[model samples]
Target: MGFWDFLKPRSKEHVEACWPGGKMLQVHMEYDTEKTIFTYFGRFGLTFNISKSQLTGAIVKEISRTHSVLQVYSGVDCVGTTDILPTEACNIMKDWLGQY
Candidate 1:
């Protein structure tokens, strides 16, 4: 990502991770009809974009009906971890695999 990219708007969405805490996390991927590429946004401050091939999607382990552990892997290593919506996790994985 470049500095000027910050000033520009791309295809994306903002997912509210915690509304009460005022913490927002974008674990969802929005479809870009123009580019036909799914973009993942969540990283605050500095946004980083890597090769789509590097992503292995997310592993969602359910802890309860409403909770799950979401771990995103880039290659063999985990790039991110958090407990969010399992359904959402599945959607993210689908995007990572370019199935959506």
Candidate 2:
């Protein structure tokens, strides 16, 4: 598959929630049976990569009906936490990791 294909969420809820402002231009992800490499591309030259085999968990907490927080943990460290919309986006990420 194409590099960005995995970034395409399966549901409309994911499309709206994961990319609230349409700021994401593309994404590149590579994963094997046990590890994942994720790269994010934004419209305003914003980019970051998270490649970790020690991902401990992904937690989703609701703040409102349309908003939630996604917290990512790596081993004992909280690597990333950010707000998302619709909430289902959190599950998608978690499921992606579960596959590997």
Candidate 3:
């Protein structure tokens, strides 16, 4: 490893969730000290970045605790929602965002 490696942002982190009917959803996240890029798959295949400024006001809602439906919102727009494991949701909301 090079000395500057420490200054570099972390590599992308990937997580996937599968539904009963063979439907699968995956999230790829790349986070730096300043911002994070979130990529979603399955139904809505789109990728977007959320900076510190936006993350400060971002909202993550647990629509169904039992079903593990988590909704993410930026300002008034509904970015998207996913059905993932409860643990995954917690990690994203707490661990990931907490780093900033």
Best by TM-score: 2
- Which tens-of-lDDT digit does each residue in 1-100 have in candidate 3? 4546547884544432223222233444444442344433333444444554555333444545543544556777666554454545534544444554
For candidate 1, the per-residue lDDT at 14 reads: 34
| Residue pair clashes in candidate 2 | none
- Residue-wise C-alpha lDDT for candidate 1, range 11-76, written one tens digit per residue: 335321222112344444444444444344444542223344566665677777766655567888
Looking at model 3, which ten-residue stretch has the lowest summed lDDT? 15-24
lDDT of 2 at 52: 56
| Candidate 3 lDDT for residue 56 | 36
The segments of candidate 2 whose C-alpha lies over 4 angstroms from its true place after superposition are 1-35, 40-48
Q: What ranking of all candidate models by lDDT puts the best one first?
A: 2, 1, 3
Compared to the true structure, candidate 3 yields what TM-score?
A: 0.41
Residue pairs of candidate 3 with colliding backbone atoms:
none
Error of 2 at 58 (Å): 1.0
Residues 8-72 of candidate 2 have per-residue lDDT tens digits of 77433312123323335232223432334443333233344456566677677787886675566
Candidates 1 and 2: which is better by lDDT? 2
The top-ranked prediction according to lDDT is: 2
- Per the 3 Å backbone cut-off, how many clashing residue pairs does candidate 3 have? 0
lDDT of each: 0.49, 0.50, 0.45
